[model samples]
Each structure stands twice: as C-alpha cells, then as structure tokens.
Target: MDELEFRRQLYTNPRNRSEALLQEARRNNKNKKLYDDMQQLENKLEQALNVEVPDGLAERLMLRQSFDDSRQQYRRKSRWQIAIAASIAFALGLSTSLFHWQQQAADMGQLALQHVYEEMPYTSGVDEQPSLQTINAKLARYGASFEQLPGKVVYVNHCAYAGSPALHMVMKGKMGSNINVFVVPKSTELKTVQSFSDKTLHGMVEPLANASLVVVGEMKEPIEKTLHTLTAELNQAI
Candidate 1:
C-alpha cells in the first residue's frame, strides 16, 4: 500500500493487518525506521485506550485542582491572620507594661514626697518666747554662724543627729535664695563627706560643729568655702 493508504489503514483498523505489515516493514532498511516510529506511536495509542477513566474523572480532577487552590489560598490567609493576631497581642502587652511602669513611677514619687514631709519639722503655738541669742550660741557650737538675712527667721528648731540634737535653721537670703543650715554633733562616724548635684543646685555634706552638716544652695563659690567661713567665724565668737 502507499504511505498515505498505509497510515489511513493503521489509524482506521489499528488491530487488523497493521501488526503484520509493521513486522514486514521492519525487515526493510528504509521501512525499518518508519516501522519503529509507527510501533512507538501505536504503543502510545494502546496505552491511551487502555487507560480506564473513572466516572466523571475530568470533573473530579477539576474539583480536586480547585480544592488545592482554595486550600493554598486559605493557608496564605491564615498566615496573615496569625501574624496580625500576634502583632495585636504584642502591642497590648507593651501597652500594659508601659501603663504598669507609669503607675509604679507615680507611686514612687508620692512615697518620696511623703518621706520628705515626714522628716520636715512642724510649727505649733506662737506663745513660746523666741530666744535668738541662746539659739545662736547653740548653732555656733556646730560650726554654724547665725547671720540675720534680710527676712526674719520663720523656722528654727533642733533635729536629732546621731543621738545629739543638731540645730536646723531656715532663713531667706538675697535674690530669693533660701538658706538652710544643719549643725550635727561631733562624731567619728560622720567623718566621710559627700556632695551631690541636683539640676542647677549643688549640695555638700561635711563635718561641722562635731556633726554632719548638709548645706544646699546655688552659690557660685564652693560649699566648703561657705562652711569653713561660717564655722571659723562662729567658733571664734563662741
């Protein structure tokens, strides 16, 4: 048969005479290659025909593919949702921690203020006679000189320091400066002196009149200078 008629018969009646014709073509040199190619194509066609398609297999495959796509989309959306939830939880935790810290800070500030107020002296009756000379003499013993600043001394009292009463005084100074002086009784335990700076003001603690004296002021000169001058002058007069 001609090539076109052979190919037509091969496809039209692939079972009958096609196998016998292919075996004869394989024996010929030029038809050998064609026979092999046609055998391969025929085998592929047999495989395609023998493949038993399940009922609604195409529809089931399409449904499975759609399900896989939906599953992938859900997974991606779930990841985003989890990430968003974690972010919200983290934000809430941070806010809660910050709020707690602020509350603690406020409570600490109040406690500090309360402590300061507790240590402060209270004023009562005005009937008690004011003994300015006797007060000055006691302060002088503690290396503190009693100098009348421009304003009257509204507050004068003795505070306990290391079992001894230390003379404490508050007086108004020039340019709205409030002068505070404390004379501690002399003790070996109060030898070490320290100074601290708070904002613009500098304060010092040192041995004066046998006790630890802490003076706070904004004066340009060193605190030691003021302490030394006051102590020397007071000691000499006493």
Candidate 2:
C-alpha cells in the first residue's frame, strides 16, 4: 500500500496487525516511527479510560456506615471523588503528550515543513483546480486576497496553525513541480521565520502586515520567484 493508504489504515486501528501494514512499516523507517507513536498514544488513552475502583472502597464504606450520620451523603461524595480523580488522570495524561508535540512544532519553519509532509499525499496531485475567486474567498477570512494567482492552483483548504486556522494551498510550479503556500495570521508569540529546509523540502517565510506567508517546494525547485510573485499578488482584504 501507498503511504497515504497505510496511514489511513493505521489510524483506523493503531494496533492493526495486517501483513500489508507491517510490511510497509518494515520497509519505511518513517512509517515505523509513525506507527509506534500512534500505538503509544492509543495505549495512553486506553489506560486513562480504564478507570478502576479503588481497592477496599466497599469495606471502607461498610466501616463508615456504623457511625456516619448520613450514609447516603457519604456514598455520593465517594462517587464524586472517584469521578473527579478519573477525569484528572485522563486530562493530565492527554495534555502532557499533546503539549510536548505542540512544543516540538513551535518553530514556524518546522511547523510549515511538518504540515507539508502531512498534506503531500493529497496535495501532490491535481485534485481540484479552484478559481481565483474561490481561492480568495478562503483567504478573505484570513484578511488577505490575491489579485492574480502566482500559478495554477491545484488544491486549497484551511488547516490548523498553532491551534488557529490557516490557509493552505498547492500551486503548480515550473517543470511539473508542486508548491505549497501557507497563509497564517500574525501572532505575537510566534515570530516569522526567514527560511527553513529538510532533506526533502525547503521553504521561506514572508511576513506581511496581517499574516505570514510560507512558501515551500522540493529541495532543488526554485521557490524564490514564486515567493516574490505571491508577495506581489497578495492584497490586504481586511
């Protein structure tokens, strides 16, 4: 199976022991790592959800019944305590891991690269050829619009950016290359990055008055021209 299909299947059931998935995971180290992470998260959630009654609660209640003025009240309070404890355990376990993951993606450049990788399976192909008007409509909510697109738009959607909504677009580039452009609202805490790259992709960030524009493409593909074109075409819609 392809990367996208494998990811979908694995997400459907992280503990899947299908031969196809195991083979794919064996073939690709990245896939194996992702599978492991998903499994860990699944285990944590299961452990959190598996709330068990404290030992000797029945005996303790029986003991208290002899002298307790209001047995009913005491039982209710015990139930509430147990419920609260379970909720706290679940929240602590979940939030800790999620916060750590978010911190790892705190860098604007790293976040952009990570987003590109996640969406590449879908965005690499020409799934949709949206009009400039359609693209601008999506951008309008982000306080920006395009007068003329830099290139042919193949895919466009709104995706998460640091827990906020951001515009994601895939445009056709020179020599059959695909370029990813992200428009994120300006944030006080997250400063814009000049540029960033990995083994497979490289990109630059352009900070605007109302938003930061990130342009990403393959390692060797020339993205500076596309960046300039987009910078010129972008008009403040607010």
Candidate 3:
C-alpha cells in the first residue's frame, strides 16, 4: 500500500492485524513507525474510554435522589438537619465512587499521551521556538510562570485539559528528541501524580500550590532530570 492508503487503513482500524497490512508496514520503516504510533494511541484511547464505573455508583445516585425526595417530604424538619444529611450523602458518594470516576476521566498521563499523538499530524513542520515571554503569555492564564526551561523549546500552544485551559509545550531532549510539558491550573479537575507511563512514553507530574506541571518524554529520554530542573526553575504566582 502507498503512504496515504496505509495511513487511511491504519487509522481506520489500528487493530487490523491482517498479514497484508503487517507486510506493508514491515517493508517500510516509516510505515512501521506510523503503524506503531497509531496502535499505541488507539490503545490509550481505549483504556481511557473503558474505565469501569465504581461498584456502587448507581446506588449512590439513587441515594442522592432519595435524599432530595426526603428533603421535599420533610419540610417540617430543621433546615440545617436536612442540609447536613444531604451534605453527608453527597460527600460519601464523592469520596467513594465519584472521586474514582473523576480520576479515570482526568487521567493526566493518558490524556497527555493522547494529546501528543493527536497533534502528530501537525507537529513535524513546527519550527518556531517560542521565547520565554511568549510562552509565559499562555502560562499566565493558569497563574503560572516559568523562570527558565531545561532545554530548547520546539513548540508551544494552548489546549483544553481536563475541562480547563492548559499550556502545552514541547522541548528538545537528548539527541534531538521531543519532550512535552503541560502547564495546567490547579483549578482543573486533573490531579497530578508522581509518575506515569505508556507503551512509548513516560514522565512525571509535579503539583504546585496553584498549578501543575506534566512532563512527558520518550521512554529513553532522561525525563527525571528534566522534571527536576523544571520543578526547581518553574515559578508560580501565589
């Protein structure tokens, strides 16, 4: 298959392990790389979409609805008493089930990896290295500012992350590799983790007082060093 046809088939169904497509990919290094990248993206997308609902989510929702009904029927009860019960129920639901749901929905590492692949079609020709001032222009929206980056920047853009605006950046890594860094406001639903990884990439999440930094790099890249440098150099507006 030609490049266009190969890409078409690969994206349409990355799991198509037919011999014909496999042979085509094996014959062309570029096609093989593209095939692997698309498959990894598909896997991550599947993982993000297939999260199991908490064991008692429906029961909690029912309980919440029941609480609402009770409030309507017990008008004579002290307002504070009814309110307290409702609050307790809501908190219990969130603490047990909704919180897990949120964590799955806002899996920052998976989201970041997906974003990188989604932008792959456009990132190749990106040649501009944004200045620090230019980069901070976007970061300012999240109450964040970077004192300096650990390496040369290759790309920068604004993106939506976990239902909030985020600043996405790509920097140069060892041997001309690409490392992605995302600056997201603390207000966003995404809670940062210490580290995360997928088939082709791995990185760390640094949670600041008012914002979070998610740094992603190829599996072979020195991501920990970059994260250390970034945590030390990154400044947040208190």
Q: Candidate 3's residue-wise lDDT over 1-238, tens digit each?
A: 5554466567667899888889889987888898899988988988875654454344333333334446555443334345555567657876889776676757777778877776666565565778889888887877777787557888887766765667888888775778888887776556456888888888888887777788988888998888888878777777
Tell me how far the alpha carbon of residue 236 in candidate 3 is from the true structure, in angstroms, after superposition.
1.4
Candidates, ranked, TM-score? 2, 3, 1
- Per-residue lDDT over 1-238 for candidate 1, one digit per residue giving the tens place of the 0 to 100 score: 4443344345444554556567656556765665566668888977864643343333322323334457678556555555555556668987999886555433322222232233333322112233567567666656555454323354556654433456655444344444455655655433344665544455566654345656555555355665565555443222
Root-mean-square deviation (CA) per prediction: 42.9, 9.4, 13.5
Q: Which model, 1 or 2, shows the larger TM-score?
A: 2
Question: After superposition, which runs of candidate 3 have C-alpha atoms over 4 Å from their true positions?
Answer: 1-103
Candidates in order have lDDT scores of 0.50, 0.82, 0.74
Against the true structure, candidate 2 has what lDDT?
0.82
Report the alpha-carbon TM-score of model 1 versus the true structure.
0.35
Cα displacement (Å) at residue 230, model 3: 1.5
Better of 2 and 3 by TM-score: 2
Worst 10 residues of 2 by lDDT: 58-67
Candidate 1 Cα errors over 4 Å, as ranges: 1-131, 140-152, 199-201, 218-229, 236-238
